[model samples]
Target: MMEPTAAVPADGSTARRIAPSRGPETARIARGTGKQWRLFNAALSHTPDFAYVFDLDGRFLYVNRALLELWRKPFAEAVGRDFFELGYPPELAARLQRQIAEVVATRGQVRDQTPFTDPDGTTRHYEYIFVPVLAEDGTVEAVAGSTRDITDRLRGEEELRTAAAALSRSNLELERFAAVASHDLQEPLRMVAGFLTLLEERCAGQLGADARSYIGRAMTGTTRMQALIANLLAYARLGEVGEAVAVDLGETFAAAIDNLTSRIAETRGTVTADALPTVRGDATRLLQLLQNLIGNALKFRAAMRPPVVHVSAERDGTGWVLAVRDNGIGIAPAHQERIFGAFQRAFTSGTYDGSGLGLAICKKIAESNGGWIRVASQEGTGTVFTVHLPALE
Candidate 1:
């Protein structure tokens, strides 16, 4: 019985059997994998970032074209050579070697910012990382590294810092001027109002009707001016005094209502509030913020109905959002943004008696206490003023 005999080994040992070749589809997949590796290698060579590999002893194992061009050396000269021997500054070379050693020791990656000098002798900033490459036995065999030029980014950041410093100084000067001017101007305004009152009383019978009317208008103008100065001073002084503390908004609401007791009674305004959260801010400023909003609601009532204002607070992200919604002559869309500026009035003084600094003051107070204020309203509908403030722990 003939059985196909196995071939004898040339070295007198058993011969190993061969497996059949893979199908054409398998070959195609293998070709695709090789193509991907070639594409990756091409990308590494062409990318702007410098890519390289270093052995355990900090000897260059593989250096991409980008790194070679930065060094102004050929790849043959770079491989097997240490970074310090390739024209890099000693300090920088030492720092990078230390980082590589740390990566090898911890078998982890290290990332940092480094400065390097160009061929033109100008220092450039770079953000780079050193990643450990491990062998199959789980030991770190090499360190792969990449560096991105961050010189432009660093320059931009420096410019921003400089601009911020200048802006801060300008704000401080403006605040000081407002405080000093407001204080000095009050005395002269008081004298004018007092003397005008005396003149009107002394010459009451002798003065004609037109003269009396003129004097009355002068009195009104002085009163309005005084109010404007007071509000400007208040706005400038926000966050200039008093440390922030845990303040119960419920108490603030009560105090605001108390401040507007006379107006509320005159207008028969009904102001209701929901349970409010305690926030971190100056109690005095918070009370003022509430008073301004409530006062506006009472003053700008929809003539068709008695003023109804609703105050409520809710949790919003890392802060508390308090809203004062009022049934009043709402603000037009065009004037909503401008109303927040100091002395920027959308309505005439004859219609609404205000210094136009209330919302501006509220904005400053909110920002100083780490918060912000915004308004949402439509003409003839209603107005909602929202203040977001950080809640107490």
Candidate 2:
């Protein structure tokens, strides 16, 4: 942290340690001296944040070392240069000039935040403070500005915004799903309840074992449907939308596969991958996406063979393409697209006990990141689900 410095007078009348004037002693001794001013400048320059003093004409009167280091430019290059002449974008420079003019006209400070592409071509967000300096006639003379780099803060705010949006959408989707589940169950539940009553009415004289078994199956199906709906809600809200970043997909996949290590070991499944490219994506969503695809490969397997899953990725023009192929019972071509939708399953419920929201969630995450999921399969051969994510650039 940079130590705070007290301000100095324009005539440098606060400190004499750097350069003491031999012309007079009490001239500097009248209620303190230029030593303080020199100390203030010396202190402010060492601060972490960028600080500079610019005249009303937008010429940099002084800049701290931090400012020069941040731009990766020479101190001599930044000092004594007009703000317009700096490597900053033309529009941003113009906006800064306008802001300085605003402070000069109003004789007050102005604060603003903006993101800019730096000289090295990386986008950075900065928060600025512009303080107006008044002249002897009470007119604005210069502006003292302090800038704080806020790249992390902006990214967190964006992640929060994304979560709020996804939460809103998920809430609406859950409501619709709840309504559908209720609507589908109401009649079946009523029919079961009615038949149980009918069996009770007739059992005193003549209910058979067949009737009892039929009633039991009916009750069981309804109970499973209720559980499925509850599970669906949990599945929909599994992963919260998170900060999007340029993540190395290879590392992400490794972490995800590690999470499934126990299952992979139990099934003796061999998992392999190609180099996955980096992408601007939500980390949590990507994890969930991998979990679902890899989990399915493990969950559904052939009776005679241990599961073997191959994961591979490559650049596909403007996007990255990844595939999870497994030696499991595959879907028929006609049912491939339907498998990705909510509550639409080609497999029997007993064979795979799932709410069937995994692929649906994957689809949403992919589309949200400007991508999509696709499939290729044959019934006894195998299945390959491919995910495509657009490159950040």
Q: Lowest summed-lDDT stretch of 10 residues in model 1?
A: 1-10
Cα lDDT tens digits for candidate 1, 247-333: 999999998998899999999999999999999988888888889989988988888988999999999988999999998989989
CA lDDT, every model vs. true structure:
0.83, 0.77
**Whose lDDT is greatest here?**
1
Candidate 2 runs further than 4 Å off = 1-231, 238-240
Instruction: Name the lDDT of candidate 1.
Output: 0.83
lDDT tens digits by residue: candidate 2, 1-393: 112232232233442233334445644553344454566677776788888887777777667767777677765566556767886678888899899888888888899999877667788889998998877998777888999989998899999999989989887787677667766866677687677767767784675788777777777776667667665754555444567788788888899899999999998888888777788888778887887899888888787888989888878889888899999988878888798888778786477767777788788888877789998998887899999997878
Instruction: List ranges where model 1 is wrong by over 4 Å.
Output: 1-37, 200-212, 237-248, 278-286, 303-305, 315-320, 332-334, 363-374, 378-381, 388-393
Q: TM-scores, in order shown?
A: 0.79, 0.45
On a 0 to 100 scale, what is the lDDT of residue 189 in model 2? 71
